[model samples]
Target chain A: MTTTTIQQDLYPTRTGEVPGPAIEREHPTVWGSEADGPFDAAALEAHEQRGFTILENFITPSEVDLYSAELRRLSADQSLAGDPRVITEKSTGAVRSVFEVTALSEAIDALSRDPRVLDRARQLLGSDVYLHQTRVNYMPGFKGSGFYWHSDFETWHAEDGMPAPRAVSCSIALTPNYPYNGGLMVMPGSHRTYAPGVGETPADNHSSSLKEQTVGVPSQEAVTEMAHRYGIDQFTGPAGSALWFDSNIMHGSGNNITPFPRSNVFMVFNSVENTLEDPYAAPTPRPEHIASRDFTPLR
Target chain B: MTTTTIQQDLYPTRTGEVPGPAIEREHPTVWGSEADGPFDAAALEAHEQRGFTILENFITPSEVDLYSAELRRLSADQSLAGDPRVITEKSTGAVRSVFEVTALSEAIDALSRDPRVLDRARQLLGSDVYLHQTRVNYMPGFKGSGFYWHSDFETWHAEDGMPAPRAVSCSIALTPNYPYNGGLMVMPGSHRTYAPGVGETPADNHSSSLKEQTVGVPSQEAVTEMAHRYGIDQFTGPAGSALWFDSNIMHGSGNNITPFPRSNVFMVFNSVENTLEDPYAAPTPRPEHIASRDFTPLR
Candidate 1:
């Protein structure tokens, strides 16, 4: 059949029409109507209600060491110095994030396809899943910066052309996360609401936004209302721990001023059925390393 | 409407079933049923019959100088040393190609949107067109490499998930295209046949194929037969001359042993009606720089 017809975009952001962040009902908290596979009943319920679930000891201590070593090697690799996939900190010039980790390393690619991780993603997305984006985020001890509160789907839908929030992100901690060392903070139950950010997304926004996001961030008033309604929860855990969260949930992290560093391997799994199309608001989509266009399911 | 249903792949290749190159009927040389715009009747008919058309002195001499200077500056940019968008020769470290030229330079971006070029693309594709890929290919004086005989749509369909052959490529010469130097050679009337190549496409094929294509190349017998039937034509012209050809035509070039360097800015325009989906043969889609996933029509 001919597919010349272009579908309408469901979630729109960065249109510059809204004066401030506007909250709207989400498409669906959980796409998979029934829970199965490795996810337990409580974990699935928590994911549906609170928009997130934490799994302790997702990897062994030795596995964590392997991943940490890989991350360190990737950070120090001189070959990736000026590559667009390697993002450095704004002030310190230290490697802040390494995008497309799976494509760059075979160890990470294997982990992405591991049934332990892949099964849960399939259960959550309610269909076969593909890697939307994968990266290793590093926050060095004293000079690491902070990320502002924002929904990933906002930027993804506006800039990357993601059709829906039928995607999930799993962050596997490679270093210990303490309360003072800039652990991730999420507004529980915020996944039920979609906060549309105000402003037009500039061309090549990812080059800057990945360093320090100034656009597609929810207004302070909107963040306060959401925080008051659901309350904020910080994810503090040991190495090898994992946190699975919805794509549209309100989340951010504070600066790390302590003596300890925090690093994590983040992987986003998107439903194969919900592939990308044209951008809804921005002039062009982000690079493939940041938002992958490949929809081949992880085997 | 929910798009959970995955469509059937129209063109399948690299399945390891075909023993040799198989020629099949093409979908359509001209999708735009009715042609109207800047193209004259003869030019359009030539495109339909011969699968290519050449416009002499498409850009003024001064404009050619401007583009040549831009291309030189881009080639010598130290900032793009290790960038994935920049490809260098396998033998020599000399820069060979620079992908995403429009995104890297404002002058080239404006050239891509010029009505003289964009209007013809829309007229031939029979719909609104978007920039599918743009790059500046440079073959230096002595050590220049040559491309093997292959149809681009085979790779685009097998690896980039381009559904149809409704795409056109415009190559504007930045330097003199002498017969001695490496210049594009095409078989007239070859675009009407879809020649399926043999062998399986390896994973991450673009990393190596971009430098020297070893896979997805039509057999030597197939090339000889096509050359005997349609006859081989070399594109030899002055700077600023432009050649527009169908995407699926059998084309390749010989190595430049001459002192004259041949350079051209290549721009590919795809019908917006034919956007990307999952790859039909390969394991993953190529990077966005090589094969764009964006479907936003040029306005």
Candidate 2:
């Protein structure tokens, strides 16, 4: 089974009405119409400077269809130990394991390998790249399946354990995700530019407590208080779209409040500098949390 | 400094007196009086059959006084970012970080190597072991600190992208934590058992909601039910005392209302099976509201 990437560009926009479920047929498109293609040297440079960048037409609408069909096929009788799905807490990742890995479809593979996704990761991390993990989120009843603004790498990068860090995440939306559908909300170009908000915890102790009074990581509240002054925007867009941001960037999403099942696959990528420790184990890097860099240059 | 271990024959049990602070000296002397230790391998074996083991003299009284004195010495300063003596969460073995590798005081060292501790863990895990992380909690005043009931290994064993299984956490309480002092209250042997409950959205979400759910492992209602039935004994022992239980065991502490601080240090241990994948991370594990395993053992 080949991995089908979500690279649809039915609706591309540099900025505007922020396409919702309603298709913008006769509506004037704000961004370029054609697929922007793989991230070029220009896109790479822009992302590093800005902390985040968006790739248009990263996957097609049909490809997203393929992802949904395959996901449906994979969700059969998945009850683990007790219920159809258990709701438990560990020290590490916030999981939804009931949605296990669906064998990557053909279209998914191409999208993950798409230079637009990998090269951008390479540019920020300063090294060769590889997919961290491909994940599919299914928001049932869209009643805010999940929402909380926080950093990703703070849990992966083993608090002050490794050297010369470079880590990044690339998210591709499979459906039209607006703020109402729990779209990815992010602080523009805020990735590599900012200092690690919350200090270091462990790869396992991600959500054990709030960020503020903990270790090296700041609390999400603290990050929000700071991000508010900068005017953060919700990352909403159409299918076949992509987002590249530094692992250290503070980000989160709203819950899908509507009947629509908001879905997205984060094709996370990291450079040699980022995954150097164990390639599979990244904890929060304290130095990055302290510098509080700016993200505009990467763009 | 020489690391000393707790003797096996000293964990304080009911000495025919009501549970109170002054009862510290009323328990029978097992180690110094005789070398039989906390309980013989046979008694421990029996206790294991019944679920839960008590290791006496886990830490010497003198050592407890020393650590408590050290906490008093360091807490005076306003800044506690990296001070090593305050006796907080890091002092408990949960999150792996920079200060993770340090001297294990003789008291802790003893508990670390306790045969009873090992025997119980071996029975629960059915495998070899690795030390995860350690921390100490000084719950003082009306509003004491709170922690979620979760497994250290289940939450933090492998790196985020890696497929390593979970490890387990072993909490060894040094003092007789009672309800009045807001001692720790845990679900009886919930680690070996798991059950999913009805999912509900927490009221607060402006912060680290996910992590809040993780550290606050057990729901308030769940713990209350277990306490009513099994009658959770608050961990309230004198110095050189300790109690061992499963990391994932559903549990939490009450407010510390008495004058003195409610003290305890948890040293986390993991099995070798917990390998890293992302070399730089351990993704945030799934919270209780979204895990996919059978965690309901209470029913």
Candidate 3:
């Protein structure tokens, strides 16, 4: 029998809302209820069972604008994607500027403490919570680049007793997700099974590069909404809309099928069980250093 | 209240009968479960919440041969720790040789599928799990370097869903962890609190060096098992013995006080939820090129 497909729309009127059923699916076991007080059960249960779940409207409209401006500035100086490696530079083009803008922005810090957002994370993460690491995926046509599908843990090298990641905060949508425009796509349940490394050497690429990650077979039916029509979950909407979900989710972003750039700021807040390995890499409080303003609420 | 410290011998005597709580305090959360079939719960859970747990007979008796040999070879090398960054080279005496040894041995490969060990991991990581990275912390006293309390995630540079570290795996007892020999130590619940960064520049010699990660605290009593009498714990143990726990937990090793070199294989692993942002940098597995017969697993 063919497996049923599901999609979810985090924000209505937004560009890419995952189709129905994709948000939640049946599973053999129940998980993540241990720290249930602060999270949306539906979203997390979906994550525990489905490997991933999306919560749209995680970011406010105002925050979206703030991210958009910073993204525009970061990408403004970018020249021709520059081979997918995230580079911190001092050039003067859309792409280069975008990177610079991101590096200099406080947006990441704000999201780290966005009470509205962290409250849910706190529930999922248990009482004590700390910022892990943050990066802005400013996907612009002229400035930003597209990504490949892979798990995040594939890159980490472990020390003893350290906490492995379970949940994540992925905020996106400067432009709504679109099929051709490079919206996000994921492989359902790929989180559990792991393939040995292909013995490929790591490229010098920073966080943004995806081609180097191990690629897996994504579900054909699971990629669509009703009737397998919508493979790409359009995340378009007013700026500042972010989606939060577990990192194990098999998701990928489509190449910006639209003309303009697709921008989003992803900030991950882990449970107190997981702490920042380094102090310098702690999470910032906002999507960008918007007007040098502090958007972090009292945590 | 000062937590009571458990000082049970990490080693099982020849007469030490089957499973018991004696090993629980230092074992990874995985060992002994019903799904894996059969568990010594009474003997297992008897320890203090298992701040650290060890997997008994994790490495085959024969595999222990490799550790003994390698430790012997390094102990003789005297200046093997020549470069601070070199830490200790793979079997070939080259830092880059680790890649060459991935497929080299049967015993090492078996270590990957060792049902006895992976079974425990499955219990901790659910049905799905992926080996995150593998590394060997081979150090002789000549280098005289010691690590301070910190998480392993610092190297990821914080992208992907790869939050700081979740759990750590280290097999102790090249000869058995002891205060005199510089064993590994932990501050137990220290992971429950947040340790802020000192705000050092990345380029600062003090900022990025492992030798510089020192954090000053009043006492070692607050630490779990890693803490010894004087704000320290080497957590050392015999070969073939391993310890796994949360990364944020306060832990570190002391200088090798023993005349013999200290060598232990600390392979880091992660679940799908943890490896999203960075996928390439995981540590090296047993080098495939080297014969398992050539290397030894620590006591």
Candidate 4:
């Protein structure tokens, strides 16, 4: 596509007078061409129809242990105290998420570049892929907070300058994600619809939003309609399992008040063909660590 | 200036055949037009002639204690462990420098926006200013590492796409800077001459360079010539003192093997008119925390 075409097709959000949430159905769920490689016809059909797919034992238990240890080590790192990449819980001051996992850890970086993950991402995006964002979401037992319902693409399009919903996110569980411990919930087939959110993006919104996102969230009515129309599916599985979802998918999780803690190594892959332009909504692009401007494809 | 003129006037470094070290003397040391503002005639004249000026008691002792406490608290923050903004010493693993200090601490943020500092920065750049970079450099006793001789503009121009050397750095002494401990050393009158270093910038150079900068450093011959021609001056002072210097001035420090620790809060202010564009040398701009892309004026 020409640069002008790409700029014009920037999945509109936070625009126009009194912009409010609406279900847009123009964008494609998957952009990749080579569907035969990696994912079989059944899995591809499931993903296309459901907006997400789950793979059991995507990594071995031993690998999960290693990554879990890395998560713990990173969480305890005192040097990260004031760093913006490390977002803390609003109420508990515990680490909510740590962005830029690949750059932070060599092992995780290797995983991001691994063909098992990279090839599938390329096949899904139909182009060379770069990490749009990566993080480790940590939810402690009892006092762990939950994320509000939101579409990742709404924020990516408005605040991060992502031109289209041509991105995929992989969340690899490091700890067993039990239903009671706030496992991910998604509205099947919701990726087919784009829910544009209300309100102008505040400058440096990521500072507060990462801790507890308020903007770019679909209203309760829209969310309830989506749930009723498409039905809700929960991703609850053993450690080492993975969930792959479309960028525009409506997804969120509940508060984990159970004794079991939940943690996942999350990675987002964006098509290099769909690299960022100027933010469609915000005054400036979010920090590179959060919404990476680096379009260097994973080798 | 027009955009074309600004692009043409980019302080060239890491360009042309051989790109060897050379002293170019076309750019101005100070860009501000208002000479009758915060700085008196002698201070302005000293800054223009010597490339730097020191202000004693720029902040009070009680203020120093508060900032120092904040620094210690930030250094001990476990959440920052693997964050790219928090660079640790190569050998010791102690916190070397914490970038984006203003975003990290309310106190430091307030300090950066304070009129005492902000007004002088406006006077130096002769335009509205934004934070190009902010960090707290912590040099622990005995094992603290020293920076190599280089011009900050070299990296800022090549990697950050800064249009010119129309920027100023303020280093506020949070701890007493004794001669025995490692303190800042600058070559007087060197800001008038731009020293282009030899070498192509490695991709993601900040990852390693922050710990111990190897690239973009001037050769021994260049350092010797500059020191002999301009003479070297050390910034040794009691706590709460501040030193403002030109962006292109040659500067470095020695290893501190003494029992005393030296710490300083460093802030870089760039002219808003001279904001970043595409990088001149590197594959991508450095992370926002290190070389901020945010152009919002410090109001």
Candidate 5:
């Protein structure tokens, strides 16, 4: 299932134009051992029911170290000045996120296009998937703020014209996640219900550091009720563990004001057949790095 | 038992010098109805056993409204520049704390020295009590960060030279405490066991906003073990409900990024007999507002 052909020129094109169809495959290719890669029928069934699945040892320890080192270097780079793709914390100028990682680092790009990852995406999504976004979130020590409780599809549906939640995000941990360090907390079976959140859009949705904080997060009443019905679970493990979640799952993380750092590489894959159209009257306000206009399906 | 002689000059004196003997009282004066105050033999027993007690309807609705209005005015005043008592959030510049509220606002001062409040303090402390600190915490919407899991006695013992944990804080809620709005969470029976935390002291111990975050908070393993043993409890109720907690109780608050504002008035009373002696060789690092050198007992 591994292919050498890469679609580097497909990005930065005009808005509303879909890139060409990806190289087709006969069947989903399985990779890794049974312990790590649960890319099987049972795994797909669980994802369909629960809206999330964890893949242990998705990458080797050495691979995680390499990715972490590359991320440190990319964050320290001053070349991408004033670029929306690179965002920092409000008070301390620590880099909070580096979007579109595929366009920058070769190692991260190669990892994103690994045959095993694409094969799993193909199996669950049940169609050819394209790289929607590649983000590296750096939850640095003692200063990292938190994302409020929200579902990804709510923002995508309200702001970007994502027709349906035919997408999934693979969050690859670059550091060991502990309870005190503020790892991701998700409510089980929340994806089964769609909560059109009650709020207006924030002024700038593209920025990693959300200053306005007007995004449609779950209401306190809703979170309390949902939490009561389906208890919350925290995602905590060693580095290289991968969490694949549905776009509509209710999730949030606490502020990381501890010594331990929490960093993750998030790659969002959208089914090529469910490509987005802008909901706004004007041009898509978000930059290419955040909400990509390029719908180039991957091989 | 109400004496009006306030000791405003006792502060700014040398750290080791006890100001003077307090106005002595023969027996503890009881106040409030049997249902609310519980200032009896059983009440002291409960305080000794549980380390915290909540006095429902501690203040009338009008009193809460008056204090809340004065607090709003104090927070809006721009003329208090260079005043170490007024501290703001490091990132947003929103007012996080206004220390020594008794010295700044008469309404808050009267509330702090109210007969009912003093009577209750006398019953549990078993001696004449002095005002250690008076602070109004303003957790405005969308910007309030959190205080990590820690005991107040740990900081007061290490930095402020508070000998034994013979102090209590009466937190009067200025706004209705809801769960999502970052109400305080305390571990029941935690005051019985002191957790020797692991960390260096923060540079600025006076500021409410923890920019340095070097204060010794409970470790992850300790919190986990204790949480399993005695589950955490959140304090939630009407605006006027007062929570009286021991200084050694393990407690912390969540971030208040929600729309609901969480404002509270915390009045810490130290036993006159257990007055501080400087732990450090140099003079007290913190200002008088945060840690008073005054030993004059309250009437």
Candidate 6:
């Protein structure tokens, strides 16, 4: 079959506001061809078109194992030592997140600075990038909670004083992301439309536990419409797969009632030219782990 | 001596642009004479003019003891548990702050709801007040840190989605705020100015240990000029004393490299009408302790 026929068969565009002409063209599933290195013009073009691109086998299996081991070690140390950065669910004590992982673990720090990630960040951002923040998010088995539909740039700009949405979150999968394991789901082309919604959520002890403050959570109806129009994409991959996504992409995950763990390390790379100032004209309201102030450019 | 003379003597108008006839007239040094409750017209007027009011002996000694004990217990419990909200100085391990104190301690929750604080908050804000957030700040002896000059409104408006400066921070002194002990110092008429300064400061781990993020900090020259024009007022008082100040008033503290604790419990009451939306249109970037999403009005 022809590539266009295959594309049409695979991704049947749902009827709605997304025009028919837009769907006729092929959207590249994988970022780079087998011949391209980690950073390339094709990857940038795909990212510009779809607002996200998954780089298959970005890290070797051995490297993934090393990064996974480092994360587990850090998580164990933080949990054991009662590190203030470690936020566990109040009810289950399931590790929800551990922030500033690069600061605490030398191995993770080295991994963050690796050319494979940083070089691509530079290419995508079209400038030197700085580490906005780093965190290891653990979606544990059984009680792993799901996040509501939202765009991260909305919060970063509103809260962190980020001047623009010129940033990307590089999600390096340390574990296999399966269909039923509550992996990330993105609405393709949703980045073009910046949905404006902001409100507070009910306090949840099992996840994002601090007061459950939220912003820019698109309504269920709106999200459904957007998903139908844009088409939903699941980021299911092996441990070494990597996804580089724009900050403003509409995304969320399902509850991982599954038995396996779906852990990933996310490094937010903000462009040097797009560094944010204080959102509030007061002392930084957030702790460094939540919104970092260090704007030192990554080499 | 006459009350006017005492007022004039106690608060001599510092040289500079506080305005003409306003400076000449005797500002009420005290709010009520004898038979007034916590919420009074005079108290509001004083607050409007000078941006603060000293509610003398708002809490009885016994009540103070109860709240203080509860704070100490909660602080100890959180420290022992390594609560993520409890931030300690990296070098000294001295507790810099314990956030969301009302969530953990019943005594504090009750104290926050007390008529003395809430009723006054209602009066000042011209609307029912909701609990914005609470913290027990520990300015430990010797190693206690100092904060830079900035208006709380700057943060509230920029970071927390607070629409207006319709908020008051009722600071109940847990320990005596002595001059040498690094207590709060306010620029008497700075609320009217709303000086717009935003930048990064020299990293200070002793206070604001998270990221040392700050905004609208008046330049040293401006601060010197403001201090010279509007003389600084220290909120030094006995243990049972309470001071209610406007959110926009520029204030800060000194380094308690001194041998005394200047701990205080600050309950921020935001006007219901002026409740904050998200600073950005995204998922809440902040953990709840810094900017609460709970808009449940204080009964």
Taking the tens digit of each residue's C-alpha lDDT, what string does model 5 give over A1-299?
A: 88798533211111222312222122222212233443766776677667788888999999999999988988988898677788787878788788899898999888877976877776667777888889888887655667777777666655666666778889999998865466787777777666555544455654632432344555566666666666666787899999988887878766764456789999998888778776431234466687777998887
lDDT per residue for candidate 2 within A1-299, as digits (tens), equals 89989644332211222212212132111111123334566665566555577776877788778876655544443443343222222322233332213133455556666666555455455556555445565554213334355555543443323223355667777777644444666665445333343332355343333222234343444444445434455566787787777665656543332334565666555444334332122334333222112222221
* Clash number for each model: 1, 148, 146, 8, 0, 11
Question: Which 10 consecutive residues of model 6 chain B have the lowest summed lDDT?
Answer: B6-15
Point out the worst 10-residue segment of candidate 3 chain A by lDDT.
A11-20
Give model 5's TM-score versus the native structure.
Answer: 0.56
lDDT of each: 0.83, 0.43, 0.41, 0.82, 0.70, 0.66
Between candidates 1 and 6, which one is better according to lDDT? 1
TM-score of 1: 0.49
TM-score of every prediction relative to native: 0.49, 0.36, 0.34, 0.49, 0.56, 0.43
Error of 1 at A179 (Å): 1.1
Tell me how far the alpha carbon of residue B116 in candidate 6 is from the true structure, in angstroms, after superposition: 75
Query: What is candidate 3's local distance difference test score?
Result: 0.41
Per-residue alpha-carbon lDDT of candidate 3 for residues A1-299, written as tens digits (9 for 90 to 100): 89977533121110122221222222222234644554556766665544444556656677678777766555443452663324433222233222223345677556566666666666655545544445566454322334443334333211111234443555666556533334455445544432212222223323323332322212223322211231223333445555655544444442321234565666555555444231111122212221112223226
**Tens digits of per-residue lDDT for model 4 on A1-299?**
65554335536776643546565667676665445358876777788788898999999999898888888888899998888888888887888789998888898999998888998898888789999999998888655656666789989988988888889999999888754456787878989888777677888888888877777777656776776687666787999999999999988765543345799999999999989988888999999999999999889
List, residue by residue over B146-189, the lDDT tens digit for candidate 5: 78777777667666777777888999998988654567878777
Give candidate 6's error at residue A90 in angstroms: 3.6
The digit string of per-residue lDDT tens for model 3 on B118-213 reads 555544533444554443455553232344444343332121124434434435344445333335655554444323222222222222333344
Winner on lDDT (2 vs 5): 5
Which residue window of length 10 is worst by lDDT in model 4 chain B? B2-11
Docking class of 1: incorrect
Best by DockQ: 5
Candidate 2: stretches off by over 4 Å: A1-37, A77-110, A123-126, A159-165, A192-217, A278-299, B1-299
DockQ of each: 0.01, 0.01, 0.01, 0.01, 0.08, 0.01
Regions of model 4 farther than 4 Å from truth: A1-10, A16-21, A33-36, B1-299
Candidate 3 residue A7 C-alpha distance from true site, Å: 39
lDDT of 6 at B259: 41
Poorest 10 consecutive residues by lDDT, candidate 2 chain A: A24-33
CAPRI docking class of candidate 6: incorrect
Q: How close to the true structure is residue A274 of candidate 3, measured as C-alpha lDDT?
A: 46
